[model samples]
Target: MKTFNVPIIYRSPLISAIKQQRKQQDKMKKDFTPTRLEFGPLTILLARHFGFCYGVENAIEIAFRTVEENEGKRIFLLSEMIHNPQVNSDLLSRGVRFLMDTSGKQLIPWESLQPEDIVIIPAFGTTLEIEARLESLGIAPLKYNTTCPFVERVWNKAEQIGGKDYTVIVHGKPKHEETRATFSHSRSHTPTIVVKDMEQTHRLAAYIREEAPAEGFYEEFKGQYSEGFDVTKHLGRVGVVNQTTMLASETQAIADYVRQAIQEHYQLPDDRIAERFADTRDTLCYATNDNQTAVTGMLNVEADLAIVVGGYNSSNTSHLVELCEEKLPTYFISSEEKLISPKELLHYDFHNHEELRSSGYLPQKENITLLLTSGASCPDAIVEAVIRKLAGFFGLEHLVDETAAAWA
Candidate 1:
């Protein structure tokens, strides 16, 4: 992992100290145990892996350097460079404008783009159609592009599998920027369809088994399938890929379900399973895997509650919240400011897509234990602030500095 020279404000002394100590102790980052930071009555258990990932750091470095170097020229991002609000707002404060929203809705008309204006592709990448449009505008999308290499690897994997005469089954949100780009690219080579989760994949299985009428496939899938995609023909032989941010277990379960569906439908033997279901590898992002796994490790310790910090709309963040909510009372908040008090907290429920206030979130016990972690895109400074806020409620703010000094 190469480090970046991001803004200092995003760095956290406490978190950095702990991370540095752990790196010195275990350079490979193979240890999945959570870091314990105890301050008398308050105990914070931090996940082993969290915060800005390699792709995010690379994107941030490129975006910031672009802004610093191209001073006076109009800068436009194809969409959000990343899911973090602070990062996007920093770019906006630096005079960078977004051309479109996450849903591909045009925020600025395409006709307004000038030849000299810099256009930055997001970390999730963009559709080939958008790339062609940029080329037509005489803008080199590649030069200013900050697409994550991990995402590009997914596109390459899809191409490789599609070349083997397999339909691509993308497990992701249909309208997500990453999935849309992947669907556009894979459909160009082979028939591709997007399935949001295990539910949709199960529904797709019915079509494969011929239990559902083929005529209704169009209505059932509607805009999810590729152009000219025939449900009867394309669902025969398939391979699965994902948005790289989905829950790893759910993605694996969907793959297993589809593979079994193919086996049962075609009556294929174990050795001949590849004929119907392409034996493809998992395409989840490394950060997603590590973070999810760290969440599992964090759950090993009994905590009163969990606080997950990230953008409410972030898929990866939402999955973390889901993992925490399964076993404990979890608070999904964008920042520490949402920690209104020890008794009450304001948090976002991604399932309902709303911000709600909760009472008696914190327990009345003298010694409080908490599990704290953030999404791949969240800054460590935000996480530090959250810890400080919680410490403030217990008058243990000094303990943070003491712990950092002792660790250092």
Candidate 2:
């Protein structure tokens, strides 16, 4: 609940006023209902919890502070700071460069890095290999590290489960930076493997039950399991953890499935289940839970469509779009500028990783309703801009200003 000294450009008066009014109305934040902003025929239902989260604000504060404190030194980020393109672009405009892409592809040569050069570890953290590499270069990775504490908590959880002699089964995208970092950390502590979804979990369960051959395990889970991991030995006792940004429900489902699998495989009674399975809650981040829950709340209201704003590569943002798309038409856009016209718009399909043009995105009805929300990494200014653009279509700029003032 702490506020950070982020760049003023990322803030919006309208959004701030609305948030301030809500804070005054509900001090404990027990309300999950969407905030209704009415302007003539257009109604915007803003999620109660969205936009910059604690991890993001912390990263921004540390990143900008690093830039300000070190004026002349070359600055490099291990990867995209927080998955929002605008925020990353802003940092780039300020002379900060990225050493690697989100997929762990090295963009800059490791030989170029020097001990004096300021290197920032992103919110997603980095692999142990990368940390050791930085240390070998005489660069202290922790001094400018902005790795989120919530992520570190997942690693700690994995370590705790490992201490109990349980093989760590991570439910997450294997290629994601957070997952890779977690796998690196957890494998160092114990045998670890990454399962992307229920399908992968089912296959892993087959191996655990001895229905599949060990050779098949090596083939199916290549590069996803820790080195020296023996399927026959390590899969005996398992625990579940996940990338913090994953969908909370899916994580729970996977954990439940794996727990049931272990019980059935060993023919263990209820009391003996703990011997084969380490029962624990899903390690989802707070922002992920709040944002996903807010999306569920937003779905209860009737709306023409939903507009989800965030970086296309953002896992959390894509999940938000998925949640919205399940009930109604949803547009995944990074910026308000994507609202090209009243009749036409450009949006990105996160799954396809391509931009497409859509016609008749807006309804012809006089009374328009839209569910608007953004990912945790998105800036409030971007969400406000989208609202203003939509309001412009209905000539409701004055109404928006008056509403913001009244709320203030």
- Give model 1's TM-score versus the native structure: 0.98
> 1-408, model 2: which lDDT tens digit per residue?
687999999998989998888879888767879999998899999998899889999999999999999999999999999999999999999999999989988999999998899999999988899999999999997889899989999999999999999999999999999999999999999999999999999999999889998888998999999999999899999999999999998999999888888999899999999998987587899999989998999899999999999998999999999999999999999998999988999999887889999999989997989999999999999998999999998888778788778888
For model 1, the stretches where C-alpha displacement exceeds 4 angstroms are none
Each prediction's TM-score versus the true structure: 0.98, 0.98
Best candidate according to lDDT: 2
The CA-based lDDT of model 2 is what?
0.93
> Can you write out model 1's per-residue Cα lDDT over 330-357, one digit (the tens) per residue?
9999998899988888999888889999
Candidate 1 overall lDDT versus native: 0.92
